[model samples]
Target: MDTTDDARTRIDTTVAHPARRYNYWLGGKDHFAADRASGDAIAAAMPGVKLMAVENRAFMGRAVRYLAEQGIRQFLDIGTGIPAPNNTHEIAQSVDPSSRVVYVDNDPIVLTHARALLTSAPGGANAYIDGDLRDPEAILAHPDLPATLDLSRPVALLLVAVLHFIREDEHPERIIETLTAALAPGSYLVASHATWEYLPAEVIAALTRNNTDGRFQARTAARFAELLAPFDLVEPGIESVAYWHADDVPGPRPSAEEVACFGAVARIR
Candidate 1:
């Protein structure tokens, strides 16, 4: 299907999408009734889900800011969910106004709203692609990606809270290695993923039952760590999402149970 047709067919408001459900968690208005229902169901089961989403967003901001501070200006954010406040481009450009970002996602609904994340400072650039993380080459070779980001230079590759959708059969580690190998030396690979290891049995069962698409297969922290093995992890390696170089913002920090995701930033070298 063409872009518009693709969007119309793929965006099923009848069921909840991870992006839309996440938008619901973040209090964004871009979700449907089904999305809200599923999100609420998950929240009811896992009491700390809303806080987990919030902490994930905060971790994204901190990770991007740290990459920018390290003088990395180009970003390739895959599995970029619905546009939310303090997105990667927003955080990166805030630190370096000249930073460039190219966002990619498989969801057509996200593509429909991709323009929302494309706004950038005059000297910087932002672009979006209707692509999937399963197909890293398509993302890497997309015309817009090379047009906006200099892959030969250090770029930050973000895979936050999305890899769980990729099943073990998909060979996630090989996929990550392929993507990281393509980046220039000194480039950063950042990711956060959900885990059953941190959750209670009842909550985990409820979450698994509620996952409509069977897209997520929550793994152990050990499997999550293996995903980062190809790269050199930065300081505070593989900490809880909330504690990943967390800074005390004005608001209250989330509790340990509120952070079911693990986050890490690693260099391609």
Candidate 2:
């Protein structure tokens, strides 16, 4: 549990942040007034925004469970937001008590909440790396990462709902390659990103503007495919967060209206 305590007071409550806003949308108590304001504005524009958050979390749990059941003992979850129930470590360790997880986030508030998310099983471990997704090397080289994870073994790397925050100009491919290539062949890469392919023109414009704080980068279908190219995609390929690995549990799925996210799970060679 390498949580950074030097950042609690440094967090600004002025501009909204993706992680804090997301926490607000998910009904978490760690968000600020600015986050709530931003989240409410986005929700007003897209009524399904909260639904997307919930579904994305469900997808995370399913993906972690799937990987753990496949015997993945280590996990690297980048862009981890405020502490929430059914976190990566919880889901994975429930399947196998020896599972170890390291969560990474750049948000200072998220770092403040890191300790709450670090509860681990007796035989397992959970740690947090206060770093950015753009700097995968720093995360990989962090002291707590290697202390809890075995790079030579299969690891499930989760980038769920966070890549959208990284603009395309950042060369997301190189980052993915660097992280995925460092893992064992049986390792898995699971991510969910926002896409314009599911939204209408007007809605896209408004949503894009809402994210104009230089935080998220909405991508297209083609670009999404390129990110998953480094690994062999699992069944059903990349699809809507609600459609990927969807179980037969209920009513009609979210309409094709304006989905800005797609999810996929792939394995390294």
Candidate 3:
């Protein structure tokens, strides 16, 4: 089928998708009733779920800006959800208008809105590919990716708030390894993952029960680090998204338990 027909066929409003549910959590208007129901069910179990989503977004912005400032001009943002403010390309191009970004996601809704993610600055470029995180090879093989980003040069791989959705059986470590192996030595890996380490036993149990679809799998800080492999972490490693270079994010940041996510930036060794 053609891209348009494929997208239309894949979009089922009756089923809850991670991208739409995440858009609902972020207060975007693109989600359907099913997405809202799933989001609400999770929020019912963990009252701070929305807060975690918001903080995770902020962490992504901070990481992109940091990488851009470090002279990185290319970004590979996997699991790109519905278009939102301060997206990876926006943040990166803001620093250097020539920045190039290629976003990959399997969501058909995201595919329909690919144009919004493609708006680049005058000198920069952006591209969107309908792809899944489980298959890193296909993402790297997409024509748009190579056309938009030179893999021989440094590139920042942004896997923000999407890793937890990749179940243990999916072999997330292998996925990361495959992606990182395709990057240059100076390239970086910026990631944030949901963690269960800080939650109370009751909250954890409730979250587990509410996760009927098995969409989430929160990991500990140590396990999250292990997934990154040989990459050397940057300073302030494995911090809560609320405090990851949040110097300008105002006073009284939320605790790690409330955020329930860990973010880190690491270099390709």
Candidate 4:
């Protein structure tokens, strides 16, 4: 990871970063004015945008917990946004104190706050790598990652709420393949991605037109599932993040339209 000054110099406060915007949506204080503007603009187009963010976050927590309960003690979480409550390591370590996790993110601001994500339990270990999801090879080769997680073991790969930012031209499927190829069989792929399938055509058009940063590219359920090729979807399949393993959540959950994201956990086959 870069030093604090190096990371700070790399950060462009003028532009809105996805991690910062997401932090703003989650009501965190790490975002700049640009992020708030971007978030507010999206919210104006889709009133339930905040709900989508919240539901997606909840899905990540549930997925991590489920993986931990299934005896997965190692996690590689990419696109780790600003450290929020019950982060990957926190949830996994809560299940098993000896759990180990490696978090990767591209945002320099996130790197500045990486210390928060590195706080592991007494028996567990956590590491943060300043890397991009678009470059799987680089992330996989990061020294901290290898030191924290053993690829030969059945580690869980968490891509929650981050794949949508990967444009089609970037070949997100290839990225998934590259990363999963490094993991051993029995490794789990847990992901939640934004989808346009639940939105009306007009709403989609409006949102698309309003998208100025071109940071988000919502995919359909089928497309998202395709990215998980060679991996079998766990029971319940790809469904709204609001409802995916959400039995423990309070009643009167938001509608699919309100939380327009598909989430699922799949296993390497």
Poorest 10 consecutive residues by lDDT, candidate 3? 1-10
10 residues in a row with least lDDT, candidate 4: 206-215
Candidate rank order under lDDT: 3, 4, 1, 2
- Writing each residue's lDDT as its tens digit, candidate 2 over 1-269 gives 33365676668888788888888878888888888989998888787888888878878888888888888889999999988889999998899988999999989988777777788998999998888989988888889988889989888999999888777678788888888878988889999987666667787788778876666787877888888987899988888877777776387777434445788999989
C-alpha lDDT score of every prediction, in listed order: 0.86, 0.84, 0.92, 0.90
Candidate RMSDs in Å, in order, are 1.7, 1.8, 1.2, 1.3
Better of 3 and 4 by lDDT: 3
Residue pairs in steric clash, candidate 3?
A: none
Poorest stretch of ten by lDDT in candidate 1: 248-257
TM-score of each candidate structure, all chains considered together: 0.94, 0.94, 0.97, 0.97
Return whichever of 1 and 4 wins on TM-score: 4
Best by lDDT: 3
The parts of candidate 1 lying over 4 Å away from their true place are: 1-6
Cα deviation of 27 in candidate 1 (Å)? Answer: 0.6
Candidate 1 vs candidate 4, lDDT winner: 4
Poorly placed runs, candidate 3 (over 4 Å)? none
* For model 2, the run of ten residues with the poorest summed lDDT: 1-10
